[model samples]
Target: MRPVRVRTVAAAVAGLALLSGCGSAGGLESTGEAPSAVGPARLWPDLPPASAAPYDYGEGETARIPGITVPGDDVHRLDPVTVAQAGLKARTKRDSGLDELPDATVRQIRDCRTAPGDCPVLTPYYFDLTGDGRDELVIGVRLPERQLAVRAYRADEGVLTRIMSTVDAVISVELAGRDLVLRAPSVISGYEYRTAWSWDDRQQAMLATRDEILRVPERRGERTAPTPTAPAPEGSRPAPSETPTA
Candidate 1:
């Protein structure tokens, strides 16, 4: 898929501001001066292995776990752990299952897509399965005629394998005790309200629609006055004063 071209100027500016503060005395001098003593260089902390052994989900046709709905276009199985190992950050819309896939597999998937020209180069939506601190990859696709495909993957056997029923734009994904729900409007005109779905078992799948009424939160009190700005730091340059012309 091709990359999306949205510019995140605000985010870039915020990052620059943070970097600018790093060299400032106030930022680096947070800790008081230490006693004059020489110390040996500290050893780097021992860290866990970068990658885990590829997970294995027994070879066979992917079975449909009860309450899960698999999408037709999802071509492969993926292991979630492998996705994380490949340097894809977790829990954001752009974390595609690409890292989980073999290079050839990813290229093939990209080429096979209809209107691959319009597909996003980066995957959007970071999905966490099991919620044991690792995140799975999610890929979304828009077909030519208003159809949407959402696929999830976990790493297995050095390859990404798809989880059962982990596909669809509108799906009810399970989250620990709390059900991660998805709602979509029905195609029929009379059914204007959206239909809801939830995951059934620990595995991913969209279950039957369930009606749940939620109370909207009430508005809070009126707005308060803006706070005053802090004065510039001591020894910092002040704003330039205007000079009168003769």
Candidate 2:
């Protein structure tokens, strides 16, 4: 597989040292003595994944994803979603009612049921996948039939142009540095399917970069899963509370 062309991710942190009250920092530290193992599978945007990729923590205690070189702090700075939303074609369409219970969001879902293209965009995640000093907007929208619409947008000339889009039964959408991850329940017991995307500078778009069907044994009642995960943290909505929360 072609190694992803990018730079050292730690530059963002190192750049922070130049700021006041900030100093040198550390990169991901490996827990094991041996070098990390690499997953063999390679995925592409034009193809469906044959199987899940194996996990390797790499040089860090946490699993280190290869080919994901991004400015850590930059992702937090670019409010890509708001920039995209500002240029949305459907931004003119307004949402009615408030505190009306589940019926509110449910009604919005019904209105856009037949019109999958018109579903309400819930929250968005931002990351500088393009390496152009600008962040891309990864927005997931809620639709009827328990489906989701995930898309990425780039602001060009003060206009948010739709760069990519996909639909699935998604549980969550998240932004992690250069990788935009999504999760959904699977039919297999003790396992859940996850599809992840990374910004490809060459493609000038967000591509399905990683796919994993994980067998997580730590959580209780793996048979049952709950709500989705947001890009902000473990438990939070994707909607920006203040037009861009870092």
Candidate 3:
């Protein structure tokens, strides 16, 4: 019994010694001083808030095509050309003070009925932009001044609703996941504007969620006129391979 007690005491001492040796090992070492934290500073707090809302580039605006109906709840089954035609006619009749489509663009739409080869409507893309199980239809109509009318439509119970509508001097249009991203050349020599429209379920429309100007180093050598202007032709426009006409 005495021998057993001694062995227990020796084992406890050995465990304590091992723990003490581990405690002598190095701990966290300081690298350097971290930069001071700077938080956003609000400026002009005393100024009165603006009375009117900020200008909306047609975001959160949705309208149903009057004459056009989706045969089924499937947007993929609808003809894109017919949808564009109906939308054009409806816009022409609307009293909204928005700029009217140019006569040349109207003619192109009309001519597409007989000559699809020369249609200005780009090949339609189907994407589940709303996160719904079904796909929505996205189409682009080439306009004058290199502007492209990018529209998104969703169909439910035979009713076709235009969920989004925006015209831009597009350098490129991309579908990043469910978001629609548009890149446009900025008046700033070395920068470009990128806007992203995202689905808003509450509004039942697509909203411009992000708009930023990014430095485009590759275009630094290209000199665009500093004055406010429209987008250039093919040079700065979305390439045909990327947005080929249907």
Task: Give the per-residue lDDT of model 3 (tens digit) for 5-87.
Answer: 99999999887776665533633344589999999998999999898666634557777877877776788888888888877
Ranking by lDDT: 3, 2, 1
Predicted structure with the largest lDDT when compared to the true one? 3
Ranking by TM-score: 3, 2, 1
What lDDT does each candidate get?
0.40, 0.54, 0.82
List the candidate 3 regions with Cα displacement exceeding 4 Å.
Answer: 1-37, 54-56, 91-100, 217-246
Q: Candidate 3: minimum summed lDDT over ten consecutive residues — where?
A: 91-100
Candidate 1 Cα errors over 4 Å, as ranges: 1-109, 112-116, 120-122, 156-159, 164-180, 190-246
Clashes of 1: 16
**What tens digits encode model 2's per-residue C-alpha lDDT throughout 1-246?**
233323344566565555535434443433479877988775576786658436421111111122223344233444433332332323211122211123444445555546646547665676676667877656665656787766666655444444555566777776677676778888886677787776666655566777889985665664466778656764655654676656
- The per-residue C-alpha lDDT of model 3 at residue 24 equals 37
Q: What TM-score would each prediction reach against the true structure?
A: 0.31, 0.43, 0.70
lDDT score at residue 53, model 2, on the 0-100 scale: 34
Winner on lDDT (2 vs 3):
3
